[model samples]
Target: MAGGSNTNNYGGDLSEVVRQLAVVAQQLARSSINNGDAQGKLFKKVAQSTPPTYQGELDPTILQNWLREFEKLFGAVGCLENSKVGCTTYYLKGEADLWWQQNEATIRALPGFNWTKFQDKVRDKFYPSFLLKQKAEEFSNLKMEEMSVTKYYTKFIELSRFAKESIAIEKAKARKFESGLTIDLQLKLCGQVFETLDEVYGRAAHLYALELKK
Candidate 1:
């Protein structure tokens, strides 16, 4: 009788363990399906929105802002190659679609329209190769005398996009920004440690504003 009771108890424990594992597996499967469906729905919504138009030239600041919004939407929706098809569908219908229609020749030349690569092509088209050297030179020779602190800082950020290779590191960007400031401002900022280009800009701008008030 004792041996029989022990066998029964062991069987009950084994059944409980199996039941728990089955529940966990079912939950995991449902979660995966739900996540995929959610992403698909998001992608569809973005595919139906107004698409951005690219003229021969894009305002660097506005282009960057638009790209950021697009990246967020794309990332939320799994950023798949099929998303490129949806992008084309969304873009090819509006007046803004003129850009897509015009650029179709370039688009067809790509091996395949991967969403990320498609975005890169658009960026290259609007950013332009000739502006690269000009932007770098502008950033390198930025002067506090030519523009207000805010304007100079804004231009610095816009130009940095073109010279990303040179200012790829945060420290390099900070140093480059400081180099463009007047000698007095640079001297004032010399002892301060800054973590980002923006922080340097803010500090320099504050000092310039004080000087203006004085």
Candidate 2:
């Protein structure tokens, strides 16, 4: 009796042998699929174990976005404490890498390099106090007229980060965002209730799209 064969002296039966071979082949195929699935899961686990690399030059807002992604990635990986060295040098590229090289000695000399404090240092280097103030002023004076609705909203959101105290509440942020829109958009949203800045932006974007088609 070969593997997967009956004990009825089935050796002389070619059909029985063929049937057993087919069954064996099917079992092998199933095992292969199971192994492939296990390997796929392992690959995904390893890939998500580390943060994604940061590419290109550094700007205050751009670096901020990168840090946000880095935080989320490492937090998910359960390695937030190792963030200082693990997230910085390994993932840097282009101008960011050059900046790291130039400041490597000073960075290494810091007594206790806290990631949050290091972020502040990077922000200060790119967006000084004066520049933040200027951006806040610009955000305050921005109007939707003559500018595309998307650009106006994007600039508002970008500058709003520095104006932390001003747009702290969703209601206040929504009001400020609405106030910056064109009179037509304001009139369109007059009777609507928006709970967040994002909601207001959504409605305003829809109205702007309609306005464009008219």
Candidate 3:
């Protein structure tokens, strides 16, 4: 009777251990399925957006535009921060693809690697100093002579990237933009205390419309 009681106790303990193992397995399986489902949804959204492929163009404007498009797509789809570099790099083709394949290990090994870091790497490779300086000069010489206020504003925003320090502050940005407007618009907008670039643009546009009517 004592031997039988000992055997029964051992069997019960074994059974409990098996049950706990089964529960852990089931939990792991469910977690894996949830992760897979999330990845599938993200891929489907990215496909629908038809993200552009990059083929190692050296043009700063082209590179900038490609980066801009991806940024927009990432925002629109609610892309995970950890996944942005993977998604953007997957679109690289030809020379760009080869370049990434070579440097990927090193880039990935860097501390705290992310989308911004990836962007910096790409710019470092493609955006040469001469091209950057040329872009800055273009921004410095920008004027609203022939272009409408809307068009001038668009170009101003686009070229401002190359000359960031010139308009680093909101007041400076407003002043830089105001100075670029046509002489007539400048004369009209001279004594105002505009706090933001948008405010200056709005006032200039309104005045421009009035001048057109006259």
lDDT: which candidate is best? 3
Scanning candidate 3 in windows of ten residues, the lowest lDDT window is: 35-44
TM-score of 1: 0.59
Per-residue lDDT tens digits for candidate 1, residues 35-80, read: 7897677657776665464343445555566666667766665566
Arranged by lDDT, best first: 3, 2, 1
Clashes of each: 0, 0, 0
Decide which is better by TM-score, 1 or 2: 2
lDDT by residue for model 3 over 69-156, one digit each (tens)?
9999989999999878877888999888999999999998999989999999988988888999999999999999899999999999
Report the Cα lDDT for residue 122, model 1. Answer: 64
**Candidate 2: tens digits of C-alpha lDDT, residues 6-68:** 644565587788999999999999999996776555445535666555554334567667777
- Which segments of candidate 2 are over 4 A away from where they belong? 1-59, 76-78, 93-99, 102-111, 191-193
Q: Report the C-alpha displacement of residue 110, candidate 1, in angstroms.
A: 4.4
The RMSD of every model to the true structure, in order and in angstroms, is 10.4, 13.3, 2.9
TM-score of every candidate relative to the true structure:
0.59, 0.61, 0.80
For residue 73, model 1's alpha carbon misses the true position, in angstroms, by: 3.5
C-alpha lDDT of candidate 3 relative to the true structure: 0.91
